[model samples]
Target: MHDFSWGQLVNPEFYIKLGGIYLVLFIIFAETGLFAGFFLPGDSLLFLSGIYSKELIQEIVFIKSDFLNVLLLSSLVSIVGIIGNEVGYWFGKKSGPYLYNRKDTIIFKKRYLFQAKDFYDKHGGGAIILARFLPILRTFAPIIAGIVQMNKGKYFLYNIIGSIAWSFLLIFSGHYLYKIFLNNLDFDLKKHIEIIVLIMVLVTTGPVLFKLFFKKKEGEDDNSI
Candidate 1:
């Protein structure tokens, strides 16, 4: 087995280098479906998958065209993401009540689950789609859908739409934008991947953090006053 440091675990590039495309698919699966996967790098990993599309795609299949390879990779990732959500929904449906009474552990947090519940309540079925872009919410929204016993057909429809949109948008952005920078601006995303990943994390997780800390605290203060 390959030894992975904590830093390496968090780095999107390390995943690609360590296990290539297959590892990427597993990480996407875990992050989207498992409660313990809430902290995994989702958006940045998808973005980096685009940057390394050629190399990663070669592992599974040989494609002559770069665009087609990225497209194929994105499609595969979308399918895995959809399956992951299905697993999460099934888990929630089976043990929805137990989860509420379960205490927090290193990998599990009641707050994130509650946050997902509120998001689902407010947005109704749309939360499944919207939560695909949000970090913790994305991880738990499907589970919440199952917990509430959302219509199976409706959940499936939103799951497909959300997974496709999320996978295609981020992965394609990385692939095409990398080409644009290299050809036109003489910039290489691969060289500056650290900065790019950092930005992606901040952009994707910023709102969740803001709500968790600032907004929640403000509400507490208001209640106290």
Candidate 2:
């Protein structure tokens, strides 16, 4: 519930509160790029952060930099996320069976592996796009791809695509949405567009999750076959 009045988030002190947008970028990187990052707040936090940033842009005009700064910050974050995903993939590939079932871990073994495998089995590219929006899944999806020994070329492609789609979508959308409101001097200028984007993301993700879920269930049934 960032105050929509007087723009609290844009305060130079406030923007610096978490090192401005860079903090957001880093969090996105870790969440999207790292498997262990599944525990991090992804969607809700990003959404709220965006809403706050809207106020910042309007109330605090002197950001000490221009939109380029925001772009650079976001791009850096995207790189971090992508690299994190690769490393996480390597770890999952190396440690999936053991660490997954280890008493030290809280991950539900069957659930994690099942979703990963399911996504890998059916829609290879689709998982990357769909998972970009879904929390935790973004980090683990690529790692799962790596564990399963997905084609390196193909994996790289999907990874890049997902990273760009997810990273840009969130950062730019949040910033732009704020711009619209600030420009119009209205509090709810593009609430409809925001809602639409959210719906689109969910609508796009539904089939991927469903396919994975059902595929996993079928695989379980097949085990008894």
Q: Which candidate achieves the best TM-score against the true structure?
A: 1
For candidate 1, give the lDDT of residue 35: 81
Per residue, candidate 1 scores C-alpha lDDT tens digits across 1-225 of 467577877788988998899899999999867789998889999998999999999997899998899999999999999999999999888887787789999998878766766666667567888889988888987877887666788789999999999999999999999999999999999998789878998998787888789988999999999
What lDDT does candidate 2 reach at residue 143?
72
Which portions of model 2 miss their true places by more than 4 Å? Answer: 1-16, 19-22, 44-65, 96-119, 188-225
> Each model's C-alpha lDDT?
0.87, 0.61
The TM-score values for the models, in the order shown, are 0.85, 0.60
Instruction: For candidate 2, report its TM-score.
Output: 0.60
lDDT value, residue 11 of candidate 2: 30
Candidate 2: tens digits of C-alpha lDDT, residues 6-106: 44332322332455456555566677455456655555444444545533343434455546544554465567667766776676677766645655346
The residue pairs that clash in candidate 2, if any, are 10-56, 33-84, 33-85
